[model samples]
Every structure is written in structure tokens, then in C-alpha cells.
Target: MSELSRWEDLFREGNLKELSLGAMKVTREHFGNSVFLRGLLEYSNYCSCNCFYCGIRRDNGRVERYRLDDDMIYAAVDSGFIRGLRTFVLQGGEDPEFGTDRMCRVVREIKRRTGDAAAVTLSCGILSRESYAALKDAGADRYLLRFETADTELHSYLRDGVSLERRLKALEDLRSLGFQTGSGFMVGLPGEDDELILRNIRLARKLELDMIGIGPFIPHPATPLRDAPQVPLEKTLLATALLRLFCPRAHIPATTAAGSLEPDGREKMLSCGANVLMPNISPVEVKPHYLLYPGKICLDEDGLHCIGCLGGRVAAVGRKLSFDRADGLICKRRDRVEAGT
Candidate 1:
């Protein structure tokens, strides 16, 4: 059988151990035993869109919304920098207050504060091509916008009125603008199956993504899918392994949703193929309010505590936290350009 068929069979049969081991080998071969760190700053809980599965959707009146201004955002970056973090993912809902110019300034300020030694990653949802180009010009290095699922119907159903085609176009725009673009999907999303998961992996390879975030489906009490069941921990890990095998050079994170499902979820993912961990750097007071899903981990800890604890967990699995702001092979190309190669 071909490699794809082999992976499909393994996924269909629930052979997680074998799949994970194969994935680990693939990861080590491409990235060695070093895991990159991206300090996640959920700078805002306010969003314009009302996605059905999210906790902080615009319609969720129960959410205590908050948005950190430039000063607060810079302070968070300062804290992460002091904790040996060289990368920051400034993620938030699509808050209208963060206009293109304001967002550009945020990226420029972060780059300036770190003396241009940091990789500023943005997960602030979709934007126009002009906005994307503006941010890139302001020193943004990477952009993560998960397509959620490859299936169009499910994508529309989960994202309310948003179309999958639009999301894909945004991703392409990011790639064209010279950003290290990343995308991913949720495993075990309602109405999704094993074949769909395989398709998601294939889509990642087709897109030539620099990173893929494979997170589990965790239901939130405030959302429409509140009654939905959580995706099995094993299935999520299996999807992670599959992604690693398919996109060997892509950076996959042991997402926080995995850790919320089980104590050792992140550790297990690190062993499987995940080479990235995003410790929360948003202020401790706002962490609880930034909940995208219930029972999210590390909401109580600051950047210092989260990094310290994560360091021990990463070391426990025979890997070390990387200070490098690497976006798979994109970093290599940037280095080459700088060196006039």
C-alpha cells in the first residue's frame, strides 16, 4: 500500500501507538529534539463574528470581554522576552478597534522592542490583502488562520455565515505577502470522519503550510454546541501524528486544548510529532476571560510561571525549549537572504 493508504488504515484501526511512534521519528528526523516556543497573547476577547463553537463569540453576552491596548500588549511581550521567549503570537477575536493601522503599529512596536530579534505571529482572524501587506511591512513574520475543516458545509455550519473559500483566500493572501502562513483544522468536529481527517492532512501538504495546528473539539457551555461531546484524546493525537507524517517540515503545536483534555496531553503530543508549545503571556487577570473553550489550562499562571513549568515538562520528554523564532523552512530562507546567499 502507498504511504497515504497506510496512514489511513492506521487511523481507521485506532492504532495510535504505532502512528505516534512513526510521527515522532518523522519529527526528530526533520527538527531533531528541539521544540520551539511561541508565547500566545490573547490580547482581546471581543469578536465581531459569532461562531457557533466558540466561547467568546459576539453573541455570548455572558463573556466578560476585554481588549489590551498597546501598552498592555507591549508589557506582555516584555515579560515573555525576559522569560527567554523570542516569538509572540498576538491572537484575538476580530475586534474592530484593532484597525489595520493600529495593528501595524502593534507589530512594529513589538519588533522595535525586541530589537528585531523576535518573530511576531498574528492570529487575529481574516483581513483584506491591503491589511495583510501592511502588517507584513510592519514586521509581522507569521500568520495562523485555521481553516477548521476542509468540508465546505461543515465549515459554514460551524463558522456561521463565513465561507471556507473566503478563509482559503485569506491564507493564500498571507502566503503571497511573504508571511510564513499556517493553517489547521479541528479533529472530530461534528459531522467529520476519518476520511475527512485524512483530507485535512492532504490539504496541509497541498497548501505547503509552514505550520499546522491540530486541536481537539472541546465543547463550551456558552456556545450552541455546548451539548456536543469532546473529541477523544486518542483521535486528536492520531490526527497530530498524521499531520506530522504528511507535513514533516511543518511546525505542529501540542495545542492548549489537548492539555485541557488531559494532564499529560501536551507531553504525549510532544512525543508524537508536535514541536511547538504556546505558553499564555496575556495578563493573569485577563486570561480567564480569554476563554475560547472551557477548562483551558494555564489561565492562572503568568508568562514566567507558564514557561518555567513548560520547561520542566518539555525536558521530561527528552526535548529542550527552543529560543529560536523558526517558522519551519521559512527561517532558513530568511537567513539566506540576510547573508546574501
Candidate 2:
């Protein structure tokens, strides 16, 4: 019943790749050769809070702020749908333009336009429980809220006084509302140790999360941690594999941050244990400005290009892109619900 002993053994004794192979097998068992694609639409970059590690934080005067109107957002989703995408992840900074009513309208419109064929995911920052419920009523199927780190002090330091309790409460609220809730952590963060990373994995399992997104800590030149060390690729891969080993059915992404860190990072992630790919379908002109960290890949490409490129990458790793809208963690949970166990 010791948490560390359970999760830590997978990392020791030069067994990183071995653990990855086991995780990959588990991933295949649950997901087959299908990798789900979520079209990423970064509709706005004007954030209200200034997280120390983010490039688009409010205090960073260099960021070019922009918010796409309803027409432009619909246009982007329309383009992605034509290219075989069935899920749209509406991500953005905490822009006030996307209030509860406006966001619900967007979600309702996307569902209406796609005949409910497209799954809408909201990744806008923390909102009230009422707002979360309203979005769900408007047909949003998934929600992503990264916990960032498991350590409370580290979370406070990184987010500039924000409490981890509030974040966890928001996650709980989302799950209570039947969202396929996702929470993530960063490997090699400024104050993180192996123990902290293992706790993060434990936390994900404890939450019964539907999905988890693990990526390396990449520093942004414009942020407070500009001089912090970049997370080693080996460490990040180890963390991804470990998450898969523990949470066998969670939807894990080969994050664009990883790919930007190493050219073949995404492919390696697929082999390691990842089962999701979020291609940037955001407005191309605004894509370059939505920099969470430096050196983000595929900013130069459009939605169609990302679809074709990621499709090729998925195939290269001997897996195929999944066209199913409900192919992620939510479907896996249905069995548990039906059995009432």
C-alpha cells in the first residue's frame, strides 16, 4: 500500500524502456492501433493571470494579444471537420471574452453545426461550477485542467500565489459534472524531484482521471523561469511511460512540447504509451502568438497540414488515426458504469 514503492520501482534499475514496452502493450490492449485526434483551437491568448512559466502571461508585454470572434472560431472548426477531425479542443488563455454565455453558445453552435458528430472540449482556465455545468449542458464532452505539479509549494511558486486547493476543487467540479476530466503535470519542473513526479502519477490515479497529459518543462524566454534548465528527454519519457503503466486506460498525449524538444519525440511517445494527438487547428496567423513555451512545433502549419502530417506520423509508428469522436477515456469508463461495480 506504499505509493512510492508501487510507482517508483518502474523507474529504477535501468528499466525505463522495459516499463515503456509494458505500457505500450497495455495501451494497445485498451485502444488498439487507434490514436484519437483533437483539433486544437486556441481562440484567445489574452490571459488574466500571469503564471511565471507561461509566455502569454499578462505581465509579459511582448505577447501579441488576440481573440477570435464566433465567426472565426466556427470557420476554424469547419475547416478541421472537413479534414476528418471529429473533436475540437477549444483552448485559450483566461480571456474574459469567453464568458460562460459566450462559451456555451460556441459549444452549442459547434455541436449543432456538426450534427453532434464533433466532440467539443474546453481548456479555458478555471471557472465557476455553474459555468462548467452550463458548458456541459451546451454539449461539451471533455475538459482539461492541468494541475501543473503535485507539490503544493511548487504549484504556488510556479503560479505566483495560486492555491493548489482551488485547482483541485475545479477538477472535482468538472468530474462531478460528467466531464471526461484531464489533469497533467510537468516533468523536470524547477523544484521537482523524482518523488514529486511519482506523486503526480499517484494523484492522477487517485483522482480517477479520464486522461493525463505529461510533458517536459520547457522554459520560455519571456517568462520568469527563462534561465531554468530544460527537462531531459530521458526523464520526460520515463514519466510518460510510468503514467501509462499505472493508469493503463487514460488518454495520454504526445504533447507538441515534447515534439518541439526532440524531433521524434511524438513518435517515441506513441511507442512509449501515448494514445492521443492534438493538432493545432487554431487560426494560423494567431498560432505563432499562442506560445506557452519556446520552440513549439507546427506553428507554421495549418489545420489540414497538421491532419495529414500527424496521420503520417501515426502510420509511421504502425498505428492509424482514429476517426471516432468518443474514442477516448469516457468510452472506457462506460463498462464500469454498466456493470455497476
Error of 1 at 167 (Å): 0.4
* TM-score of every candidate: 0.96, 0.95
Per-residue lDDT over 1-341 for candidate 2, one digit per residue giving the tens place of the 0 to 100 score? 56446546867554776877787888899898889988889999999988999999999999988999999999998988988889889999999988999999999999989999998889999999999999999999999999989899989889989989999999999988878898898888987888898899889988888889989889999999999998778888888888888888888998988899999899888888999999888878998899999998888888678777888999999999987775456545764786796
Model 1 C-alpha lDDT per residue in residues 1-341, reported as the tens digit of each score:
99878987998898988888899999889889999999999988999999999999999999998989899999989988977889899999999999899999999999999999999999989999999999999999999999989998889999997999999999999987888988998887878888898888889889988888988889989999999877788888888888888888889999999999999999988988999999888889999998888999887777668777888999999999888887658546655787899
TM-score of candidate 1 to 2 decimals: 0.96
Q: What is the lDDT of residue 106 in candidate 2?
A: 93
Q: CA lDDT, every prediction? A: 0.89, 0.87
What's each prediction's clash count? Answer: 0, 0
Give the lDDT of residue 3 in candidate 2: 46
lDDT of 1: 0.89
**What's the C-alpha lDDT at position 326 in model 2?**
50
Local error of candidate 1 at 230, Å?
A: 1.8
